[model samples]
Target chain A: MLLTDLVQELGLTPLTPQLPLDEAAGIERAYVSDLLSDVMGNAPGDGVLITVQVHANVVAVASLAAQKAIIFAMNRRPDENTCLKAAEEGIHLFSSSLPAFEIAGMLYRNGVRSLKE
Target chain B: MQLSTIISALGARVFVNHNSDTCEIDHIFAGDRMSDLLGAVSEQMLIVTHLSNQGMIRLIELMDASAICLLNGTPPCPELQEAAENAGTPLIVSPFGMYESCGIIYSLFKEDTSSL
Candidate 1:
């Protein structure tokens, strides 16, 4: 799904609105994990990450994992500095009230798949 | 999902059984970070992680997780194994990577759910 569509469908609040949604790549795969090491080692490139980790290291890990966007579950939001870092790293940031499992299930039902697929 | 069934599916080796082969695993929480696992802990949850340290055993014991499967065939140290054995927490080592292990288990979950 397109980034804009994902934002609309999931009712996600954009944390990095300055990043143009239209210019961003589409998301066909997603990995749900709060572990930065697991994400760095297993997450697919150019995919979306659904996690509850809102620290600055998340931005670094997302960038290293080549994730196009990250959805912070459970309505968790990082400080503005972290958001700025994400924006600087060219990674889109979104927030959702739903937990990571529910967000992943919704994405899976919408045809998004894990990295192994 | 029985712990033994997951062990067979992942081609995993059991280092500490704790007589938990028959334990029912109702959830799978895959992560390397203990803090993340801490929040999702349950008595029937199987933790899939790459961390093979004493802290993992402590987390398993503290959270009362059913079992913990270490991916990439990483074996726990003797101290860690002793800790798990002492705590009666099942420790499994899987030959598969984190992604493949989670995928296989997730497929099993899907099949089990669909059958019902």
Candidate 2:
């Protein structure tokens, strides 16, 4: 299943529903990021982005990179401004306190549907 | 369960809650080496490590991970916290060593496998 679908299945709330991450579909891979450059350098297209919070610039990155969803971590919640920006940008927003590493492990084990996979 | 519950189970100290106050968790990842982390992690994953630095933080940004757990009782540095705050990241400190802390958290979350 795609990260966006997983977020929905998990019954998580999104700070924004109009962002590119939220609107983008058929995402085949999952990518967890905390750094901007690393995502720029290595992340594949149409993947779910898992992070801690919903910042304004993250929407820019998602737009530029054409990501699928943004999952916030560390029990970090999104602010109203960030949610509005995401809705305007059409990015899928998800919040989880699971910590980046653990979430990644579960998704990987549960079968991260990569394009190649 | 709740992220706070997992952190408490691991005996980790919370420094900030950028968005985690309302976040829920399912599993976790424990490691310190960046080489091992790149291109092998998952979504909504929790990260546990002993290395707290700018490089690691930057890596986490790229990884798009859920949260971070600092082990060996290492406290978050001012720079680390500031960077995390700017990125809206959560940086928690754990007094337990890597093995013990991982064990505690893994058991609490009912997860045993590693991300790699």
Candidate 3:
């Protein structure tokens, strides 16, 4: 499914339009993480981000590493500065109320692939 | 659905990226151990953990994840916030335990129907 469609279907919030839902290409799977070190050491650039750390640094880190979108779990809202940073970076920020696993489960049901064996 | 709904649904607390409540998400992942996450490879994934440290920011940058979720209602450490701001990656906090949070997210978002 398209990113926009998925967003609407799942009832999520976007911090910015940087991640164009229409531009769905190369995004073959989903990866979730909370540790920055782990992400840097292992994660690929072809997936999305579902986390709860609300800060501008997350934006910079995600952008630098090249992530599709950043999804906030547990309804973690971002501050003004983080929003501005996300806007500047053009990074897509998404929020969900379904905790972390629930959100992941939903995406998996929606046909989103995973890296876990 | 608006990103705000997702946040509300997941019961996550937004420390930053409030304006990003309109952003869209496709998938998610959960883990606190940096080594476990780093060892795996995937696309368009979000991370869930309880460890709030600046180093986590660097790891997020390296993986290029969609976002990071601090589990167990733990707030982001000062250094983590700084790194998040600089990195421009959205961060969130969840009150639910890691296991429960993952279950909720998976049931609501996971695509594996047969498994369910």
DockQ of each model vs. true complex? 0.19, 0.08, 0.20
* Candidate 2 vs 3: which has more TM-score: 3
RMSD of each: 3.6, 12.9, 15.4
Candidate by candidate, in order, the iRMS in Å equals 4.0, 7.8, 5.8
| TM-score (0 to 1) for chain B of model 3 | 0.77
lDDT of 1 by residue, B1-116 (tens): 78888889888989999876678888777665567778878878888877777778688667777788887787889887887887788899988765456667766677678421
Model 2 CA deviation exceeding 4 Å by range: A2-4, A18-24, A113-117, B1-116
Sort order, DockQ high to low: 3, 1, 2
Q: How many residue pairs clash in each candidate?
A: 0, 61, 119
- Per-residue lDDT for A66 in model 2? 72
Q: What DockQ does candidate 1 score? A: 0.19
lDDT (10s digit) by residue, model 3, range A1-117: 567866887798876755566775544455566656555544457567777667557877777667767778777878878877877776678888755566666666666664433
TM-score of predicted structure 3: 0.50
Selected candidate, larger DockQ, 1 vs 3 = 3
Q: Who wins the TM-score comparison?
A: 1
* Chain A only, candidate 1, TM-score: 0.96
What lDDT does candidate 2 reach at residue A42?
49
Could you give candidate 2's per-residue lDDT for residues B1-116 as a string of tens digits? Answer: 66777776766788868777655555566654475455446766667766688867676666666677776577888877776777666778877644345545655555523422
